[model samples]
Target: MCPPEHFTVEYAINPWMDTKIAVDGALALKQWASLRDTLTDLGHLVHVLDARPGLPDMVYSANGAFSVDGTVYGARFKYPQRAGEADEHRAFYAEKTDNWRFFAPEQVNEGEGDFTYLPGAYGGIVLAGYGFRTDPAAHAEAQEILGRPVISLKLVDPAFYHLDTALAVLDDRHVTYYPEAFSPASQRVLAQLFPDALLADRSDAEAFGLNLVSDGRHVILNTEATAMGHKVRAAGYLPVHVNLSELKLGGGSVKCAVAELRP
Candidate 1:
């Protein structure tokens, strides 16, 4: 994870970003530190990425890369603002680790922001979101590279630009998402894939409740998602709340701040 050392809404790419509202740099750092500490306390190993000078959005490390079966798929950012981040991530993985293969995508794909793994009885099933930051063609390329079935889901809402912002995969049988963020066909696809998944209410979804990180038993989410927390607990998972309001100014929260290394 990279700290928000250079984080700021200098320009607006997503609907959530407003250059007029100044981000609290100090508060963002504090919140990011707390999140890192919380993950460490939860028995997860945390890896820090060096924050580059000009890449402000580098703090949202989930968009950096996607790893599966020891192979790292580097991001090809759609926007020029985040274009430099792809190379930095590739270099980090190339230099910092061994026993990993790297594959830079030929098409534009925002790493985990659009590609999420779904755990199930099958060996591997990936949910690929597109029609926003990610190109739909990249779905096939990702599937070929990873050798997994890729389910393409289309995003319809500007507020929920990335799949990570609109949905959270909670183990094999369940997921949490905002139905309206997806196109009607994608909504049907979700219903078919996860018949019993928890659907987030408008209030919770607007609070970025689906922008969460789960470790099978525990879920880390925004403190503002009070109602969503109750639902998570009801579904048999511990809800850990963290105030990432300052980071939200830059259009991210708990999940965005993390990048999982899948084996």
Candidate 2:
């Protein structure tokens, strides 16, 4: 997780971003600190990636790269506004990590923003989202790098621009997502893959409910996802809440700020 040092909504890349509505930098910092602390309290190591200037969306660190085992598939952003962030991620990995193989992607992919790895689901599979921020060709590239079957799920809703905005992999076996955010074929694919999936209603989804992270049992929900909290509890996962109303202005929540680095 990177600190929201330079976090702001200067550009309107996504629907949630509005340059007119000014961001509370101090509040965003507090929210980021809380998220880091909360995850720390949950026994998760929160790695801090230094934030760079001119990249407000750097706060959404999950888009940096995708790592599993010892292999890292570095991100190649679609939009030029976020293009610099990819190199920042690559540089960080080269400087910080040990013995991890890194691959600079040729295809356009937004790392964890589009690729979600379920280490234990279907004996391990990557549910890759496309037709939005990520390119479908990137799925094959990722599958080769990670040595896992990459399932292409197409995103339709502009609001749910990234896959993380519409889906949360709660654990190896469980997931919760907004069905409408995906295309009909994609929705059917998900239903076939996760038959017992927890479906989030439009209201909860619009509240940024699906943008979450889970340590299998504990799911950290964003602000105003009240219905999501109830749904997760009903599905037997503990709902840990956080107030990221300020961060939500930039269209990201817990999952976006936190990148999963699997060993």
Candidate 3:
């Protein structure tokens, strides 16, 4: 059978969010609205995962899981509270598609948050970032399961819990990231791979909502990231920013909201 078509989206549900992880609920909801509006404007097919009772904190889905090829793989978060989330996603994927898998119950891995794909980078190599929610052992498992090389990198900051939070590669040569979020080795690797990358300074990165989506030339970001927004525009890209401060409380932005379906 052929693999199913792919598309990315974010869910609006919250309350499942850990209070420790999210400082304020009211602010996060506002951010979610901004992110939602932006995705809708961009012609993305936003699929809203049904809200589960007692799972009020479900808005942190950027860490939930992601799809690779035709198979759906759920992430194993380092946080114990999030372990049950994998089961929830497994059920969601099973209902949506037949191809479903996990990172071995014992292994740990968060999907899009820690994992990303760059089609032009080494025949579409998949880079899985570790040192945050995803464990190193899980990265190896992902490599074996996906049948592609999964490069691992350690994220340097706690605030940037996942790779996507601090760095997102928009295309093969261009990347959106905050340099402070990367370790020395990871920085070097990033430099070697994306020689023409657009690295944003801390203030601009935070203001621009750095980890957003890019369909090659068009980048979707938060309007709040003004400086970064201007830089992206200068780089010959159409930068679309929506307000997603509410969603930020759940610890993700536009990148976490939408999944991309590749041909």
Candidate 4:
């Protein structure tokens, strides 16, 4: 995880960002540190990525790249503001990891932000979100590069720009997401794919409840998602709350701060 030492909402890419509200840098750092520590305390190996001086949004490491089975598909950012991050992430993986094959696709894609793996009986299914930051064409590229079946899901909500912000993979068969964020066709596809998935209400979704990460048991989510927390607990998962209000200023939360290396 990269510290939010340089995090600020200087530009508005998503609806959540408001440049008028001054972000408390110190508080952001504290919250980020707490999140990192919490993940480590949960017995997960946390790796620190050095944050660049100018790339403020680099703290949202999940957008950097998508790693699966030792192969890293470097991100091709849609916005110029975050374009430089792709190279930095590629270099890091190249220099730090051993035997890691990297694929740099020309099409626009926001790495893990749009690409999420669904593990189950139909394991290795990649749910790729598009119509926002990611281009729909990249789904085929991802399938070819990763050698996995890709299901294209069209995102319709600006607030849920990335799939991670709208959908949370809780376990093999279950997922939690805001139905309105996706297109009607995509919603039908999701229902067919995950019939028993938990559906979050508008209030919970506005609180960024679906922007979570789970270890199949413990779910880490935004503190404001109280109702969603109760729902998660009822679904047999421990909901761990973390206050990332400052980070929310950048249209990101718990899942955005993390980049999983799936091996």
Candidate 5:
């Protein structure tokens, strides 16, 4: 996780980012610290990536790299603004730990922003989303890099730009997502893959409710997702609410601020 020390909407990259809108710098920092604390409180180790100047979106560390079993698949951002941030992540990995291997990709893939791992014995299959920030070719490239099957899912909605924005992997066997954010074929594919998956309503989805993190038992989500919270409870997971309104202005919340390293 990286601190929102330099977070701001300098330019509109996604639907949520509006140049006219103002960001509360102090509030964003406070909210980010709270998010980090929440994960630590849950017994999860939190790592910090130093925020670089001219890279405000670096706070959304999930876009930096996708790590699994000590190997990291580095990101290649579609936009020039975030292009340098991926290399910074590789540097962080190089400096912090040497036991792991890192691979810089030739494809335009926004790391965990498009890749969601579905757990399996040997590093599971990756549910990869495309047609937005990630390129379809990145799926095959990521598959070869990670040595895992990459299932391509297409995203059609501009609001739900990244896969993590519209879907939350609840656990190894379960997931929750907003169906409208995906293509009809992708929606059908998801339904076939996990029939019992929790479906987020329009209200919940717009509130960025599906942009959450779950540890199979505990779900960390935004405070505005009341309906999704109830569904999470019904699914036997504890829902922990966190207000990321300041960060939301930049098109991210709990899940975006987090980049899980499965080493």
Candidate 6:
């Protein structure tokens, strides 16, 4: 079983999001400590990003960028208010690990939360959720850059604006997603790719419950979704739930809290 404290964290400081549910100083600190404790228990290398003063809700936007093929492609967010986030990540990319690279598209595209990797034995496929975060052209650009096929889909729900917020494919064949958020065309494409995807119910998804981290039969999920937690366990995978309600208000969850660097 993988423990919790093994993750490396890089979070943005945001007071607006925090105060939404009254996530103030002590409350925020306690919540972060809980998250850190969970990560440590999971055997992940945790690294907390230094809080950037005057930055309001940058962590939520960070979920858009993802790391793939040893490169970290920063996101181009839709909200103009989040434009500065791209530059923030650019600086982080430069000073951080050399293994992390950057991909900035002149066109608009949100990165990781909008896209999920389908790692296959032969090669890998990427599912880009289009509409709010990722543009159709961005999917094509990403495919060209990665030299792989990127399947694009329309993300229907406002609450589940990003792909990660709606769906999570854990094992090679098993996937957890809110069916209502996907279009028929996208569903057909997904069937072509993942023939037998397990769908997650909507109520659980709102809590960022369906966003999962997996290592083979082992799965990591947010603690808030007790029903989904039961489902994951029923599927025969060891489930590790970490409480991150504070982070969720910032538009992120457990999946966004860490960048997985190992297979």
Question: Which one is best on lDDT?
Answer: 2
Across 35-84, the per-residue lDDT of candidate 4 in tens digits comes to: 99889999999988888888889999999999778888889999999998
lDDT of each: 0.89, 0.91, 0.66, 0.90, 0.89, 0.65
lDDT of 1 by residue, 1-263 (tens): 99999999998888889999999999999999999998999999998998888899999999988888877888999999999999988987888577678899889999999988875725668898998899999999888888889899999988899999889988765788989999999999998888888889778877989989999898999899899899999999999999999888888889989998886
lDDT of 2 by residue, 83-186 (tens): 99999889878975675788999999999999888888988998889877898999999999999999999999999999999998999888899999999999
Worst 10 residues of 5 by lDDT: 117-126
lDDT of 3 by residue, 6-99 (tens): 1112222222234445344455555565666666676766666654544444555666676667655567767665566667666666675545
The TM-scores, one per candidate, come to: 0.97, 0.98, 0.82, 0.97, 0.97, 0.82
Instruction: Compute the lDDT of residue 234 as modeled in candidate 3.
Output: 91
Those runs of model 6 whose alpha carbons end farther than 4 Å from true positions after fitting are 1-21, 61-64
Q: Residue 221, candidate 5: how far off, in angstroms? A: 0.6
Query: So what's the TM-score on candidate 2?
Result: 0.98
Q: Residue 262 error for model 5, in Å?
A: 0.7
Order of all candidates by TM-score, from best down to worst?
A: 2, 4, 1, 5, 6, 3
Cα lDDT of model 5 by residue, 126-209, tens digit: 888998899999999988888888889999989999999888899887889999989999999999988988988778878989
Stronger candidate by lDDT (3 vs 6): 3
**Model 3 residue 140 lDDT score:** 75
- Report the candidate with higher TM-score, 3 versus 4: 4
What TM-score number comes out for model 1? 0.97
Rank ordering of all candidates by lDDT, starting from the highest: 2, 4, 5, 1, 3, 6
Q: Cα lDDT of model 3 overall?
A: 0.66
Candidate 2 vs 6: which has more TM-score: 2
In model 4, which regions exceed 4 Å deviation?
none
